[model samples]
Target: MQQVVIIGAGMGGLAAALRLQAHGFDVTVLEKQPRPGGRSSVIEECGFRVDTGPTILVMKDAFEDTYRAIGENLNERVEFVRLDPNYRIYYHDDTHLDLYSDPAKLAEEVERVAPGSGAQLARFMADSAAKYALGMAFVERNYTQITDLANPVALRRLLQTRAYQNLYRQVARAFGGSDKLAKAFSFHSMFLGLSPFEALAMYSLITYADLALGMWYPLGGIYRIVEDMLHLAQQMGVTVRTNAPVEQICIEAGRVRGVRLASGEEVPADIVVSNADLPYTYRHLVAPEHRRSYPDARLERMDYACSGYLLYLGVDRTYPHLQHQALYFSEDYRANLDAIFRTRTLPDAPSFHLNVPTVTDPSLAPPGHSLLYVLAPMPNLTAGIDWEAAAPVVREKLLAQLERIVDPDIREHIVWERDYRPTDFLHDFNAAHGTAFGSLSHGFFQSAYFRPHNKAPDVDGLYFVGQGTYPGIGLPMVHISSRLVTERILEEWS
Candidate 1:
């Protein structure tokens, strides 16, 4: 049996481990974190359970297919509840919108908010569905080379998808150029750490998935998915070792030999898979001379995704107005996005994703208490902001904003509090430029075959599975990436 070593027990790595193990490889997963679920890990504080990363799970088919590959039922292992009115959008106009998965209800809401929009909403859904179908087909598979872009069939499909239009434009045209509704639809790009104005129009597929497929929550929390994956991995006889930070990917004459842990233990393997942040992986783990394609200067020149400022609070009281997920848009949405991605500065008025998980899964908090997760998109570490000095000020402002928006005197009721900065993402996960998600933003040039391939260009027996590689970010995308990578490995080994 061929020995395989996977670095970073993220969702992608765990999934790859299971798939590769089933393929008859001896698989061992090494994680720097104390536990599994790289970005999807849970943070426990004073009995309050909060998912520090990836609060929502979308695209059920990808998740279902993953478990089905091993003849296991994901539903049986983890309870999934579909979220209707997926998210409550609190706009800058003091008006709120509830995004429903049901088309009829959504049309009604659109018509109510913006007159004569019911028909437009229907048309938008139909067009978005087409984009979703095309986009998923394009992303779910692997991209081996740049020439794959020139494939006639792929080009035809791409042209038909109108991927050249850009997401904000597509959404604006879909909603009769209504900025508010457009923003609601197009903002899904931010989930991938890309600005709607700049991210490919193909990404409108995200909004389609959310509004059409509906959002979902596991019974225990998002981290429950991680726990379940870990359980499945262990049951399959895959060795999973946590707190085993990989110091380097041991390469011998341009081929993977194994990995060296920070503890000075070297684990030998026939193949190495990395689910760590891509830029960081190439720059830090793989030695400079051995790297043929990604040199230090080239890695530094790459455009990375924006980071986030996260605030997790275990509050004594629940806000009745809060839903499972809510987003409070900054007054000037475009300007804030510019600040994060273009100017590389903190948003003076930050738009935030507010998740009150206790509303959906009350067990996450004690009786009468709630868990609030606030994530504000900010520039990555490249911005040079003094996080240690800025965190306290930002925390006060954020708490005040929450109080003003949701509850008065909300801060007084907080029983527990913790915050994660961009630097924390860098120090903890080796995330490039302190990006909380994964690799570079999904720009047109930075996406699809243009993104890093699962199989390294020059390194034999080395693979990558995670947000940095093809079929980029989001839990579903990572799942897809893992499957694609495992399939490649199986093919090569067979």
Candidate 2:
């Protein structure tokens, strides 16, 4: 049996460990942050339970595939509730739009907002569905590396999908030039850490995934899915040890042998699968001389996705009208995107996403209380802004924003509040430039093999997994990313 040491129990790390164990390999996962889930994770304080990352479960079928591959099913272990009014969008003009699971209802809503947009919305959905089919066939299933797409079929599909057309362009073309609608539809790039204007046309699949599948959530929180996966992995004999942060990927003669813990003890294994952030693995875990292309200078030039400033609050009272998910758009959308991605600076009036899971799942907060996750997408730490100084200002602005919509005394009801910023991402996940999602704007030069290789390009027995690698970010995509990387390793090592 092959002995594998997988680092970072984040979604990718855990998925890779589970897949390899199912392949009959000896797998032990080592995470840095005292537990699984690098960035998209959970936290508990004073009886307030917070998911802390990734409030929405966008694509769930992939999650089912993940568990099924391990001889179980996601639904059996975790109860997934389908959302009827999927999400509520709050425009700057104070107009609200609730996207429903039914296309007809959603179309009516769109028609209500933008008079002629109803027909445009229907056409957009049809086109996005076609893009989704093309995406599933030629894009999502396989790895994102150019080497994987080098196949003639992929090239043919490339002609079909036109991955380089730019998602923003497609949205603008299929629909009208309403910048607000464009920004709302194209905002999916944040999952990949890029602006809608900058992300690839392939990401149009997000629209398909959203309207086609609708949104979903676990009964407790998204963490329930993570707990289920960890349970299945343990049942499969995949060892999981928390509080054991992997300090180094022990390498010798260009081959990964094992990992060294933060405590300075090394455990030997046959291969090392890194579920940790890719840049961190390359820049810190591996020796510079053994690296192929990902040195500080090389990585420095790469665009990283926006890091976020988050405020997790547990309010002592309920605001019943708030939806499960809400996007509060800023008046200046393009400037906000440019500030975060193109220019790497903080914007004056930034758009924000608010997740009030307690609206749907009340168990997260104490009785009569609400849990709020306020996220403002900001430039990664490369912006040179001080998070210590920025977090409070952002928090106040967010409160002011929410107060306008909900109740004026919203802040007065706050029983507890904690903030997580780029600095936290850096300190906790060792994310390069304190990037939360991994890598930078998913652009022409940043997709597929261009992004980062699943297996170390130069190292003989090293592997990469998670959002930082091929298939790209999001909980579902990261699982797929790890499965592809580990499946290849199992095939080779077996």
| Number of the predicted model whose lDDT against the real structure is largest | 1
Model 2 Cα lDDT, one tens digit per residue, 1-494: 88989888888888888888888889998877777877768988878889988887877887877788888867878887888677788888898887787988988887777678988888777767766766666435445344655566645656775756888887877668866567667777777787887778778778679868878989989888788778888788998888888877877887878889989989889888888778878888888888867778987787777888898988888887888888888877778888988887777777888888888889898899999898899898879998778877888888898898777898789899888898988898888888877754567566655667688878878888888777777888888787788777866786
Looking at model 2, residue 395 earns an lDDT score of 83
Give the per-residue lDDT digits (tens) of candidate 1, residues 181-291: 988888998999999988888888899999888789999898888888888888999999999999999988889999999999999999999999888888899888878
Q: What is the TM-score of each candidate against the true structure?
A: 0.97, 0.95
What is residue 227's positional error in candidate 2, in angstroms? 1.5
Please list the C-alpha lDDT of all candidates, in the order they appear: 0.87, 0.80
Those runs of model 1 whose alpha carbons end farther than 4 Å from true positions after fitting are 150-157
Clashing pairs in 1: none
lDDT of 1 at 346: 71
